[model samples]
Target: MDETQPLLPDPDLACDEAQDEAAGKDFVDFDPAGDAENPMDWPEAYKWGIVGLLALMAFTVTFTCISVVPVATRIVDDLDGGHASRSASVLLVTIWELGEAAGPLLIAPLSEMFGRYPVMNAANLLFIAAVVLAALSRSAAAFIGARALTGLAVASNVLNPAIVGDMFPSEQRGTAMSWIQLAPLIGGAVGPAISGAIAETLGWRNVLWMSATLAITCEAVFLTCFRETYKVAILRRRAARLRRETGDPALRTVFDVEGVSRSQKLWEAITRPFSVLAGSGVLQSLSVFGAVSFAYFYIMATTLPDILETLYGLSAAAAGSALISFSIGSLVSVAICNRALDGIYVRMRDANKGVGQPEYRLPLLVFGGFALPLVASLYGWTARAHLPVPLLIFTVGVMGATMLLSFLPLTAYVVDAFGLYAASAMTVVIVTRCLAGTFIPLASERLVDRFGYGVGLSLIGCFSLLFAPIPALVLRYGPKWRQRSRYTREAEAS
Candidate 1:
């Protein structure tokens, strides 16, 4: 290979693609993003292993956030609060998720710089320490700080889908990534129920101790098992090795495009997530709905313990047990939808003569979108009406079904719509909804106080109604918008 010959025209450079088209060079630049050595070509077993470990990590972090909800009363007492104690107590969950949301914007770039394994391992270790800090905290401020510290694992939350995108073909990605996507909802639903029992038998601090032990065990397994899979970082290492062996300073990876400084690329990467977030209509509608539903989930998860104990006269453990309904609902949705997701997309692509459009992912939203308002209305109004405890629990479960269903179609759509920029797009959705989740629960006790559960939830139910037709509207109008979109074309091709 001639070191001086300009590296095969970099197709990743849109400008170069245009120039080559006009010059009739018939040369396609090497694209490390999708080369034969692409991470997608890695063995399926290896990819599944990575997904499994990442799922375990995601489950751990999510559990840390929600398990504490069942113990909110104990935590408030432990912190020795005043009149405002209960509200302060529940802030723990919100603060922790806030950390989860913000961690990626600051830490994700390091993963891009170093590699996923090192950052993940390092973040896992830091996460354990944060759990320890939460366990030992003597004051509310200390506990809040520690909970935010756990947000260091935000990379796991934001990056897993990007990993899915990197490793799986577009057609098969929804099915494969469903395993990763499903973990959070399951983990979120499981923790409060089980932790309530653990809090009863052991203590609240022991809940943190239990979670720390889980995190440590998963970290040990992951450290021993997983390797880096980000293709650019992998190729950079390979290029460095060759440069060292051949004593040719010019040997470079495909990522080494002329005139694109490392800082410039990093700046672009840092800022592009927001740019894509702000620039796209498709992203805006999906993200707004995601944020609202997610906020609804947090409100429900954080408040259920209180709701059950106060209204149904259930014990702390029994109150936590109510989460079983939520967890079961989410699982049922994933089981049914994951099977249908890929088939729907593939059929649409086949119908279009092998040209794939992101809208193929929208039809499933027909079921999901309707489920949101329908269940929110029932859950909200029925709870407010002081219906039978069993009936209320059943309605909560129904809401869980709607919650998970609502999330899946939009997630698959965004992933297909954004492609290589999926991380940025996802980060936008995460940050927006997480902030909403963080603040909305703070108002939960107040909302129930002013409006009562029935009316308060009905308001939320009505909100859910607004976005229900999004899939249909997008299906009809999305192609026209995509024509005007700067990111949509790049996303589809990638």
Candidate 2:
């Protein structure tokens, strides 16, 4: 390794854990001070500034995925000789989710191999190129390909939390996570209206162009401002460089002092997340709940426009604006959860004789879960008969319920249980949800045809109800469940 020449290769800017019965050895240890430049050790203002920038990065990526699709319906129709099939339109909506689902699973692990900054910036730039291709797309196939490319490139959703976790301590992390979570929810709620308005005013191609411009601008900012945060990885790289350049056999890395390495560590870094997910019952339980809730949200996002536009005869813009109600619902739930979840955690911790687990975050789950199904049923029945907009807004309330109850549990549980692998655990959850999101647009029309909106939505509601008890059961038995995991016990002990 060279002192000045980078340790990890340029193409792969590059980047490790362990156990019991191995006395006098750390299970997992890495340098605390990395690269003289790890953002985790940056000044407070610097860290928070990166957080804000990343938040916008998140906003740009997410808003692009979600917002541009609705407006794309017009383009699809125009391309299809001015008569795109309803199902075809849904494919356009849902296929982007397929790309989203794939991106995190495929690309997130690369962060360990490469540094986080490089991976994130590269992905955003790729996403910008995809949007450019999308803007120039002449056929539906080209457009869908571009969408998938964009999705794959910007799979930053999984890594965003990891970035934040690196910046904040556990106790104060919820506030940061909460704010991060809000961006996607707001993006989902507002994307369609923005896109729809843009499409209706300018040609549909301009929507893609606008998204590309945003992506490029954001990418530029990230390249200019972002810093690497994975501490151990950076130190390992630094040590490797020092060894190569100086060629001192006695040369030791900061990581050597802390006992981390980058040589064979890359595979462990990539695979360990799955190992943690498989080994932890708590992760499994929380993942299921979170994934299902996420799936329902995607389903709603895919179907809501169809419901309003077709059934209510609302214009594209009006139907898109209806998502504002969903946005309101999400905001309301976020407000309620932020105010109350912490209080409940403290009270529960006190009641438990000064110790608490992630399960304490589940109280709102019961309220949110049960209420959503009932709300769905009400929305279905009323809307089936052409009820007032207020009735539809009430359905937004049900959707809001899901957000309120699920967000805290999902974010907190992974943070509590998997700790370092929270991003990976969230990856699993996002995969399932994004899959559901992709499927909904493909199937929404068929579902309504076969059973009508009343039945189809009611069915989704029932499924939600079935999964609602998940968090409740976890809250009840979470501690005992956690005791069975070697990792959880070790994290708690520390």
Candidate 3:
């Protein structure tokens, strides 16, 4: 055996009987390069169908995360008898993010070990139940706990990108991921945009009921249409069928050839994200950049309603309506900028002698990184100045567009760099960003109270400015760093 040979068999190749006999083991894989059962070889329409379902699921789950933002005070007052602390009220929203922080660490790995379909559907069921629980809760603790549970079930956010990676190769992944990425932005924005009106008309409980209803609808469609996309899980099933049909128990997949027990595989999958994060400085830097960028978005989500209501004397419904600008910006970016992500990468790759490197994805990040700080500062100063409603709306819109600019490329870079370990790599990024999303909003009020919107948000913008050079640095040194990384090296070699 060549010492440098990859651990996993080439997914696109047939089982080589001679090689297997030489190695004293039979390993199953996609027998033909264009095997229809292989997700990569599935019909383009079907692959896109899966992406569409994933986008819907992503929107549904993320919708629940922020739908209550517009009605947080109403929820706290109704459930807590109007006596809850400000921190407690904020926790009603932030605790859900805490659940998001914890969920992907467990869920993404489980998806890798089991399969995408069962895990996602199961999480969807849990999310529906959790949202319904939130609607029925009569106390602050119960409502907060329900939100936390809902967050834990937000597997779609973590799994969507991994599923895209499973179905689409590197060349087309950015385009597929752009659609997936658009969902959460739209979901998060639309949630607050409509929830305030719903809460005002029907009560906060109805807001949760609306989220639960959407989740149930998405789950029904998903269960009906979504197919398993995890390559190892699909191949394992194929191997199992072959074993039963041929009565050859020795037949195995490259994943199973090691004779690892389900328990061992599960344990490794669960911990792999952390191990990868611990060992990879590139991943760590990306996680930090993503975390702060994520925090900026949540801070805006949680704070914007109050900013509009207080500074501009808008009604709750009007304040919520103002957030529609975010959706508008996100929509515009997805339509215009996201499609260019893959185009830019291909251009860079072609320029690099027809070899693609993960650094190619970093070009968009350069624009996003520098633009984010400026947008953040603009949002701050515009709000502090009590600028015209249209100006504030435009600023908020730009903020939404800028966030997607940063996040979409960053996600593509991680997916490209990590390859087979993309799920775990994404889990690392998800965990860090969720933690930031969870905790940073808790301080948003204090930041505004102590420093006012201009200085407080400008401070955040300044913090973001420090990270603007990250993409440039990564673009210059990424290949060398990836060469040093066991995970990236294995992914590349494989």
Candidate 4:
């Protein structure tokens, strides 16, 4: 029970003794907690190399997601004869998010069954092909379709959290999670910041070509460097090897002893996110709040360029440069949260008699919930009043930091709550947020046109305030709700 050591159980000891006894003597697992094969026991430098690669992959996928925002108008003008409706133009940007929402359903389960290495590399290859199609597209429909395919193929965004869970202990995960989660936020911000200039100088197709290049590079590194990390998948491979070496068909891992077919496990894995969402009130609340955060973030990302153009007469490139404030704010949030998250969690666990609960991750979330409204209101009203551009930029930075404050803790909570099924649990959050990202920004332009920036944004702030109590409620009631959830209970038992 060394304080610095990971809390993972020895794979052999975790199996039911009676089940192993009844099944006969030949079985295979990592017998010692410090087994080199255990992902958590890998050399620190090696583990961090994997994390850096995953972070890069996460950055690439999300960078593609938002990179087109600054160039949406140019795209429509070139591809649609400048006659497409506002909704239709917006669809080109948002459709990618819809594809993101759909990908995790199959990818999460497949990764669980096979392993992270194969599933991720296969998806990365598809991602590169889709990006190439997008670059070659000449029509709006073709381009939207390509973007959607790319989103569907980008599995790293959803899978990275689970990979982090596989490799790091709970108390040590905060800094790594910050890197993974911050990549998307920074990517989403940096994408639009540079893309406007790229589109203006090179054209919209070149933006996609740039994305394709990044995708290709990421795939090359990932395939060559990443290895299998999922413990079940690793153990199953070991068991199969042992059976061959010893000539004993009786040799098994726990998965083999369970007597479940691959198809059945895949089917259940596909549906488990929905089941977990439907059954767990904690998940339901988190999804709602997470969706709100995503919607607000995307609404700003999709609308800011136009808003700045209209309100301040800024050029597209200048407006896009303004978004670099968001990247700056995200870096600041990472500095603050990375230093505070694990320290706070450890202190709270000690206070709770040296036991950790998922709710311990909620303190930062509660702070974020209240801060979101203030920043949203400020962002809206400043633009409405034609305030100084620097002031408006400052508000955007605050908004960016506040969003991550809510996002990082929410992610950490789900990973902690649903240990074995972290990927599936994370799917619930990603799918919900991506759905919100797809649809919410579609209405933002209209809302601004009708209500003005102040009223429209204040309305969003009000909606956020309504759900701001969610983390607090979960903190109070989560344990009882977890006890009632078959999914959470099963996760805990495993």
Off by over 4 Å in 3: 1-25, 257-259, 490-494
What TM-score goes with each of the models?
Answer: 0.90, 0.85, 0.93, 0.93
> How do the residues 165-227 of candidate 2 rate in per-residue lDDT, one tens digit apiece?
666654555566666656666776777788788777876777677777877888888888888
Off by over 4 Å in 1: 1-37, 81-84, 258-264
| Residue 303, model 3: Cα distance from true site in angstroms | 1.3
Question: Over the stretch 1-494, how does candidate 3's per-residue lDDT look in tens digits?
Answer: 11111112222232354366458577777755478887878999999988888888888877877788777777888787878676777788788878998999888878877788899989989899999988899899998999899898898768888788777777788889888877877887778878888888887777778888898999999889988888778878998999999999889776553545778767877888887888789999988888888787777777887788877788888887787888788777776556788888888888878888888888878788899888988888898898898998898898888787778888888878887667788888988988988887677668877998899888878877887888888989988988787778645311
lDDT of 4: 0.80
For model 4, give the 10-residue run with minimal summed lDDT: 1-10
Q: How much is 362 displaced in model 3, in angstroms?
A: 1.0
Native-to-model Cα distance after best TM-score fit, residue 354 in candidate 1, in Å: 1.9
Give the C-alpha lDDT of model 1.
Answer: 0.74
TM-score of model number 3: 0.93
Q: Which residue pairs of candidate 3 clash?
A: none
| Ranking 2 against 4 by TM-score, winner | 4
lDDT of 1 by residue, 1-494 (tens): 11111112233574444455456443223353545555666778888888888888878877887788777777867676543376777787778778877877755566665667787788889889999999999888888889888874556767777677667777777787678766866787778878888888888888899899999998999789977766557767877777778887766554456677767766666676677777898888888878777777777877777778887788888887788788778777787678988888888888888888888887867677777776776786777777898898898887787787777767777777766566677788888778878887777667777898877777776776787787788877887787666666555522
